[model samples]
Target chain A: MWMIDLRGIIPAATVVGCILLIWTLAVIPMNAHLAADMAARGDVVVTPHSPQDRKAMTGVTIAVKNPVIIAMTYSLDRPRLPSPHQVAVEMHNTIFTVAPTSRRSLVHHAWVTLSATLLGFVIGTTLGVLLAVGIVYNRTMDKSVMPWAITSQTIPILALAPMIIVMLGAIGIQGLLPKSIISAYLSFFPVVVGMVKGLRSPDAMQLDLLRTYNANAPQGFWKLRLPASMPYLFTSLKIGISAALVGAIVGELPTGARAGFGARMLVGDQYGQPMVTWAALFGAAITAALLVGLISFIERRTLNRMGMGAA
Target chain B: MTPATITARNLDLTFETNDGPVHALKDVSLDINKGDFVSFIGPSGCGKTTFLRCIAGLEQPTSGDISVNGMTPDAARMARAYGYVFQAAGLYPWRTIGGNIRLPLEIMGFSKAEMADRVAHVMDLVDLNGFEKKFPWQLSGGMQQRASIARALAFDADILLMDEPFGALDEIVRDHLNEQLLKLWARTEKTIGFVTHSIPEAVYLSTKIVVMSPRPGRITDIIESPLPRDRPLNIRDSAEFINIAHRVRDGLRSGHVDD
Candidate 1:
């Protein structure tokens, strides 16, 4: 009932419309040079006669002299910057025309990346929660484990990804597990940090009230700390799930992944297929949105039932 | 005399702060009889709360002997001999009114039927019979505090220690809750140690009022009420009640002179 406000929707639609307009206008200039060259090769009269001289001219300057080629820019076989329509068509073909199980299918690749992301996310969340519990309850773990967990994130994931892949591959543990570990490594930090803060959110009065009941440690945790941590847990899960998806994609980059969104991005870029890469990138973004959206949906229902719903 | 439900002897508590030793309580002693409503009336930092915490085993007296029901405070705590109500309701936001009351029973290992029965009984007692499905945030401040009282009463502890449970409410709400609390005490006949900073509140509710002061929190005077057990709100205008309230005010003023 709350989300369908026309006020918010209209402004959002305007912003997206602005972006698409800007992108379409930009495409003419970006692909103009290629379009001009294609036209010249077709024995069409071009303003800048020599191919060498054409390289010196800006795409905007070249396209002005050959206005007929503006349409050509929007329909290149492999333009430098593909028009938005080209990308949309590519995405549509891969997502709809191809069989879901086929190698050419974007659905197959999305599912491959999604499976690893979900596995790693569950693993990371469980690990994160366990660590947060230890940090909150044990003085030694708080002092020792938290510092190490923070420090681990400082190492650049790009630099670390190759090393992780090679090390695991050396032991003959290749593919999904390696990708998942990378995902787990990336996702666990937020969950650990958020959960620790949440578990400690209870005031002295709340704790003392429980003490009056002589509640045991497990009872205190299950009854008080766990329930208190729900908001924080969901916030971290949103962040962690996105991070896990990034980790899975990055995990694919190092191993020449045979099938996945990351694999498509890598293969497309290397093979001079920018349309393929653009489609894959959008697919990953949509996947991230869906994952985060699902969490947000669940969060709203849960908090409303708990009466902690945001005003 | 009824058997003493709680006893404190020569109690002294000194907190060592950066500045120096801050005496929160000094040479404090008191006895709470079964079925008594004893109110500790004092200003802030008077250790009325600290003293109550001692009885509940939430705080350790630096030097003193305190017992609950002839057993050590710690032992009594493990036996769940008391229900403590704090200044704030402190109800878990996620729990409905009924669930919050059921929490203690669940922790104490009551059966499903017993938990439900006890929750319903206390909810009815607190006049919150229809608020079972309502969460704490949905209730008024007074209603929330009432639910908290019901929570404490649910486990049927021998003693209820309240530390200014209605201090945050307006006078009108406070008055209504005070009358309800008196009725609750009379019905349950449980020993209650209430801490408040209000003179009239102490006078109106307590069977015995222990007036105190801060800076080295200690009791100044203990007044045993001669008024009848059954009290109406207008009983505050009664000569005996006014006389007791006057004495409590005098005790409070004299204690403050030590500053």
Candidate 2:
């Protein structure tokens, strides 16, 4: 089992390693301006050394390489692109070093965004399921509502976000409600489409069998359709949760809110702190990955209990 | 008179499609008595299964009348007068074998104790004992069909309508299941309407064999078996059984020739 697990881990680790190598290489070219400025100001003390001497030097020794430019890129105070370690250091400082309740801490901002995401996910899932049931059972709803649902998604969320935030603000409904509404708007579509497909998954033979038993519509829905839809529903929820997080973060961007990952990015951009922005972006990504992982965990347990093994 | 358990008078069903109207069943008439093991045998598109569905009230005849236990098929359906077993087992994969069997009983509001007792009784009748907790995928194709048969019998309905239930199984398993079905029929004493394409299967299990033709499906022959009720598998080798099987085969050949 451990060997099988290693097979999966090895590919993922290799991909991550490749990405880090690319990012490290890209940083040298991107931050070359700052490095050049620092060198001109005589801030970089470069000591020329032989390759053998460089190998002999201790860890504390600041020996510049043959190019001398690559070493300057690693220590720039204001870089166009921060190195991976620079972002890591910034993340550690904001997430662990500071108090969690402080606005400067990444944890506080992430918590604010997460609350909206969760609320939106709940509302969106409920609405999506209800609409799916309606669409499945009634021909009129299928003909009328489905096309409109698809049309609604074509309208870009980025273009719609600021207008929604501004409109809600005008009506004095600020803060979490507007953000959550946006999240719901983005997340519900996948659920609606997935659930409609799931609920209709049972074949004609199964339906005829139910009819032979003289089962009513409610009985058919509860006994056959609902259980059949569960696997599809969980798959939709995974997609919906990630989309909801994106919505919440985007919502914070236009509203100029004081606390949230989106607000942190906005502040970082305005104040020219690329490190802060990179840290907050990574924080949001980690949060989204964790949320998706949690939903997958629940999905596995539920499907297993239903005897639908693995999926 | 055994008091006909099912009677059809000039029943016709025409399905209207975008292309045109297709006659699935036309001018078909038959009578099935109580405790009868009747098999409808025909080629594909012969509407043998359609006739069974009409009796189960899953399909409606365009004209004429069909009655079950001296009432309309719809009324009989609402009364839960029969159990249907599809070609595929059609067992809900999410539910265990026991749970699948218990479904109709639960829908009809049977008490918990009664449901448990009935499920166990039917499971034993189908020889599916001790497999109550296994899901449909965990069981073999033959076992799944047995579980389906057990499900239909769970409600203690007076009639069982089976649409080629063992059609998907291998010959060895099908033969074994055929013997079990005969035993089940003897023990339960219920009227069964079976549909099949195999002549030997029709001869082996059915007390009455119905031969039908396609292109507006209608019955051409109805042969009543003179064999005893307690039939073992080796009975298929007997002179009488071979004679009956030959007649069924001839009837089936004549149906296609007429077409």
lDDT of each: 0.93, 0.90
**Chain B TM-score for all candidates, comma-separated:** 0.98, 0.98
Docking class of 1: high
Candidate 2 displacement at residue B226 in angstroms:
1.0
| Per-residue accuracy of model 1 over B163-240 as CA lDDT, tens digit each | 999999999999999999989988898899999999899999998999888998999999998878899999998898
**In DockQ, how does model 1 score against the reference complex?**
0.84
- TM-scores of all predicted structures: 0.97, 0.95
Off by over 4 Å in 1: A64-66
- Compose the digit string of candidate 1's lDDT tens values, residues A56-169: 988888888889899998889888888889999999999999999999999999999999999999999999999999999999999999999999999999999889999999
Report the number of backbone clashes for model 2: 0
The candidate maximizing lDDT is: 1
